[model samples]
Target: MLARNDQNSLRRTPLYGLHVSLGGKMVPFAGYEMPVQYPAGVLKEHLHTRTAAGLFDVSHMGQIALRPKSGRVEDAAKALERLVPQDIMALAPGRQRYAQFTNEDGGILDDLMVANFGDHLFLVVNAACKAEDEAHLRAHLSDDCTIDSLADRALIALQGPKAEFVLAKFCAEAPSMKFMDAGPHKVDGIECFVSRSGYTGEDGFEISVPAGDAERLAKALLENSDVLPIGLGARDSLRLEAGLCLYGHDIDTTTTPVEAALEWSVQKSRRTGGARAGGFPGAEKILSQFDQGASRRRVGLRAEGRAPVREGAPLFADATSGEPIGKVTSGGFGPSLNAPVAMGYVPTAQSALGTQLFAEVRGQRLALQVAAMPFVKNTYKR
Candidate 1:
C-alpha cells in the first residue's frame, strides 16, 4: 500500500464500496483508490492488530500464474529461477518463498513472492511494478512457458495473533497451517488459495479469492469478534515496525538485495559452491557481495525522543557532522512500540547494533541509535 495523492483516473478494488461504507479514508495508492485509514485512526488500528486480527484488502497487488506448455511444473520453476535469485526449483509444492528480481547491474527490480501450486508457479508482485515484471517475464521466459495474469481475483490479508482463530471458523484447516505453507481451501463456500504468511511479522493468512466473492468473504470474516477492518496507514506502520521493506521506499531499482540486507532471500543453492550457481541476472556482482559485504547496508534506527523522523531525513555521523552520511528511507512513530522507529541505509561501519548516529529533522539534529528489529516481537507460528 504505497501512499500517493488522489488521482481522478485511479482504479477501484472489489471492496472499494465496502471500504467507503465502513468510513475508510480513501486515497490513491499504487494507482488505485485505497483506504489509508479508517475512523478508528492509525494509532488504534495498529494497536488493535497487535492485540487481535486485522483484515486488509490487498487486491491491488498483481497475481500471476506461470505454467509450462509441456505440463512439467519443474520446467516453470526453472524458468522463473532465471529471473530471480531464489532457488525456485527447490521450493516444495504448497510452499512459498520470498525473492527479488535483479537487473544486469545487480540492482533490484522488485521484491516478490513465489509459490508452488503443484501444477503451476504462483507469483505476487508489487502493484506499482507488476506491469514491468510481467513484461520482463514474458520477454525472457522460454516459449514453452505461458504467463497468465489473474485479473479476476482479489487478495486479502488476515493478520495478527487471532487471525487463525477467526479464519478457522470458516475453513477447518486454517489453524494447522505453518508459516509459508499455502493450499487451496473453501471459506464459507468460496474457493480460495490460503497461505499462512503475511507482511506484519505475525501469524496470518493471505487469501486469494475470486473478485465476485471478495466482499462476501470479507464480510464473513468481519463477523468474528476478533476481526476488524484495517487500512493502509496502520498497514504501513505495522510493516515498518516489523522491519519489512516497502518496495519504492526501502528498496527499488537502484538497490540490490545485498545492499538492502536481503541476502537471505538468495538461497545457498544459487550461491557460490552450490550445484547450480551463477545462473540468475547479475550473478557475479550479487554473489561477490555475498562474500565481500556491501559498502552501505540497511539498518534499523531508534530515536532518542518521541519526535518522529520521517523519510528523506538526512543522517549524520554526529550532532555537528558536516555532510549527510545517509538518508532515512522509511520512518515514523511505531504505535506498538510506543516510540519512534525507522529504517535506512548507512555505511557498513555505522550499521552495527548500538552504534550512535544523528538525524537532521527541521534544521535540528536528533540522536539516533542503530537497533535490532523488529521493534515488536514476531509471533509467527513457525
Candidate 2:
C-alpha cells in the first residue's frame, strides 16, 4: 500500500473536497492524498461498516477497458488469458473474477479484478502497479484488443450489511446483484459500473462512475443515515480482518500464488490435462506446485496478547530459538474481533490450524498461534 511518490507529487481524487469537508484526516497513500480516517476515527468507522454502511473513495485504483477487435468478449478474454492464470474465456458477462498477473517465475506481479462486460473486458488493478500494468497490457495484448484506460472514472465502495438497502434506494438493480456481479447500471441517476464485491468481507457495491459525477454520487450515498465516510485506515483493517492480501505486503513479485495460499483462485481449466492449460506465465512451475506442494504457505496468526504483531516481525518455530522460521507480512488489531490478528508465510508443516509459533516484536518473542482466517466472518451476498 506504499508508493515512492513524494508529498509534492501526490495526486488527489475527485472526492478530495468531500473528504476534507467531512473532517477526514488526509494522508499520503499509494501516491495519492487520501483520507486515513474521518472525524469518527478508525475504530468507529470500522465498526460502523460492520453494523451499518461505510463509503470509501477508491478512485486511486487503475481502471482499464479492453475492446476486442473482433467485437466479441471471448476474443478479449482469450487475449487476457496470456497474462493471468484465471480462466478468463469462461467468465460470464456481468461476472468478475479475482486474478493475478504473474511473472515467468510464477511470482505475482499484481492481483486484480477482471469483469466481463459483454462487448469488452474491464479491469481494476492496484494503484501503485497501475502504470506498469497498463504498459504490460499494451505491450502484450494490444494486437487483439483496443486497450483504453478509464482515467475519467472515479470508484467508490459502499460496504456493509446495510449497503444493499442503502444502494437499492437509488438503483433498483442493486439487490439483484450477487457477489462478483459487475456491469453498467444507473446509480442515483448517474451512470456507473456497479459491482457486488468489495475489499472488506461485507455485502457491498463498488460504483465506478464518471469523475464529474463522483462527488454527486458520493454525496447521495453519504446522505443516507446508515452511511458514513470511511478512509484508508478502516479499509486496511477491514480487509486484514477479512484475511485479504494487500498487494505489496501479503503478495508480491517475490511470492507465487501457490505459496501465498491463493491456489483456489487458479481455475481447473488452467491446470494440467485441461483444455488450453499452462499457456500463461509461470505455468510450468505453478502447475508443478499444485501437486508438489510449496515449502511455505501463508497462514493466519493469532497473537497471545493485546499488543499487535506488526509486519516485518520475524517468526520462529520455538519461543527461544534464535533462528527465524518465517515473517509476518500483514498484522494489526482487528476491530471486529477485538484482538490482534496477522497473516504471514510459515513452513507447510507449521501452517496447520493449531500450530504454535512466535513473533519477534520490539526485541521480544511473543507467542502466536496459527489460526483460522477471516478473523471476522464474511457476509457476502451469496
Candidate 2: segments with Cα more than 4 A from true spot? 1-7
- Pairs that collide, model 1: none
Model 1 clash number: 0
The residue-by-residue lDDT of candidate 1 on 275-336, one tens digit each, is 68878888888899999988999999999999999999999997985789999999999998
lDDT (10s digit) by residue, model 2, range 265-380: 99998986766888999999899999799999999999989999999999999888669989999999999989999999998999999999999998899998999987899999
User: For model 1, what is the C-alpha lDDT against the true structure?
Assistant: 0.91
Scored by TM-score, the top model is 2
Scanning candidate 2 in windows of ten residues, the lowest lDDT window is 1-10
Candidate 2: C-alpha RMSD after superposition: 2.2
The predictions' CA RMSDs to the true structure, in order, are 2.3, 2.2
How good is model 2 by TM-score? 0.98
The model with the greatest lDDT is 2
